[model samples]
Target: MAHLHCLPPSVEPRVSEHMPQIIDMIKQIIDSGCAYSIDGDVYFSVDKFSKYGRLSGRKLEDNRAGERVAVDSRKKNPADFALWKSAKEGEPFWGSPWGPGRPGWHIECSAMSATYLGYSFDIHGGGMDLIFPHHENEIAQSCTACENSNVSYWIHNGFVTIDSEKMSKSLGNFFTIRQVVDLYHPLALRLFLIGTHYRSPINYSDVQLEKASDRVFYVYQTLHDCEVLLSLHNNVNRKDSIPPDVKSCINKFNDEVLVSMLDDLHTPVALSALSEPLKIINDLLHTRKGKKQELRIESLAALEKTIKNLLFILGLMPTSYSEVLQQLREKALKRAKLTEDQVLQKIEERTTARMNKEYEKSDAVRKDLAAVGIALMDSPGGTSWRPAVPLAMQEQQVVAV
Candidate 1:
């Protein structure tokens, strides 16, 4: 079972403190004729509302009789939905005007959101699948209970698919947030999620994740290299101030990208803005001319600040610089433990045995190191060694050792 953390004090919604009042309002609805109580259960009369399907584009008549709609035979119409369900023999229950039973799924959100965010909140959001019975019902419940028209903005994110197929329990393609974070950098995963607009479908694949990882790595590499250069020369001066072309690029990105993000969170456009500073920083670092150390430092600092702020807004910032470095170091040390000079000495001994045509000795040594995590890669630079960890850490580890 997944362990659920209590909502942090900093983030717990302030409006949730009024749950009792919200429940009381729902009780008032039952007292009115609009809602009906049958066998200790309560249901909404959908036919009473004129704008029932505006958000989902679903028609009331088209909704057929089903298990999710109305289970109580006393419901006036199949399209009517439950406000509160009657408790079963051994199910969780809460006391209400209609006896003991839990609130219906849609009713809980309506009550909770109304209790905390007021009669009507600024915005309501969920996955696209919720537009129908879930969101539609919430709207109906809140409007009738509070005598207020519900939210001003309605946002719905798209579904995620794997291997061009819909993710489902039966197909065995469902992935948890923790599972994906274990295999890839969490920031990279966040970037991958934002690579597409929030309202558009996202297809997941190993190739896409690998590409996102590369992009994140590249951005960090540029930032790290720029910091190194700035520290080395404190007096390098900028011959020219911020270039007009660079300024224009920044402005255009802000207008295009920020506008898209503000328009119901167009994450894809926001992600595209990442390229502008990345390109500018790379060019400045590579050119490495016409700038004094102090000026270069200021310029890079400004650019880095901008990128960091934007990334934070997108929820894609690295969790911590120290944590990233520590992980890299630990991975490197594990690699070095298996393949340092000591392991190579054993390999040499086996090679000598092989020269004497003792094939068994050579094979045995290879197997021994393989068991311990040592691996050899033949390259133009001669035989180089790397750990199974990311290649970026290998050089740093070698230097430290």
Candidate 2:
């Protein structure tokens, strides 16, 4: 999780230690006439809360009444869910006025949030599956206990699915971070997750992961190219002389990126916004299409800085671009079953073939390397190779789809 840059919790609140708060919360709802106790278990009466189904957008009558009746006959309403569950044989019990019982799962969440953040707080977040019963019950519990709540926003992101089915542990379908990161780069996973809108379900597949990894490599490669070009012209101080078109492009990119982020954290569009600027930078670096050399270099420099700032906001590149590139290359080499020396040996062979004007042999060598998941990129500096997803694996994905 830390590899993904998620912050560590400041304090870990356990349900056992917060029994007092849970008991108090249960008492508040009971006193407000929204809950009732039968034997040892207490249930929150769904009929008592007028706004009970607001969060879930589910009507009380929409329940499985025609399908099957709830097994618990003691409850006043079938919709009423437990605030506390009576102790079963040999189970842990807590001291409560309603007898020795533990807090219900729903009530536990309400108590924890209300205890630390107070009955009124800014936000409450959970998955879409928790909308019904869980968050709905929480709303009923909190508001009935305190009359009002300021849980200003409710953000529910869509689930990650495996082969179009929701990935869940209970369903025996899920992937762990450790399992994935062992194969692909961690940021590739991060990129894959955020590539879609938060409200849209993202399909998890090898093809999807490979696509994300490729994009990550492209971004880092662009950054590396920028670094190389900028270093060569470090003495070129012509920021003020940047062409109007280039400045306009950078300004437009800045606006679009921020606007996309602000529009409900739409990261897909934000990520897409990087493409144009990156293309402009690459064009300036490689080709001088109808522009002064100095002006083109200056424009390239400006665009690179703008992109770096954009990357800063996105938390994409946390370290030197070359280091990340090397990490990807090293991982790629291992996957390709080739060492750096072996890659160098191939490169040397290709160089000799080309020097001797042996085109067929050079092409053969390139093809052989590519067959083992390597791509050779020829530049003025020389030829270099990086790990690439094999065409055979990608073809299998197309057939699967």
RMSD of 1: 7.7
Error of 1 at 326 (Å): 6.6
lDDT tens digits, residues 282-348, model 1? 8777665625333455566667777777766776566554455334333334434642567668757
lDDT of 1: 0.66
Root-mean-square deviation per candidate: 7.7, 3.2
lDDT digits (tens) for residues 201-243 of candidate 2 = 8888877776677778888888788788778877865657787
lDDT per model, in order? 0.66, 0.81
Which ranges of candidate 1 are over 4 A from the true structure?
A: 1-22, 67-71, 232-240, 288-298, 319-401
Superposed model 2: Cα runs more than 4 Å off: 65-70, 170-172, 231-238, 290-294, 352-361, 393-401
Question: How high a TM-score does candidate 1 get?
Answer: 0.74
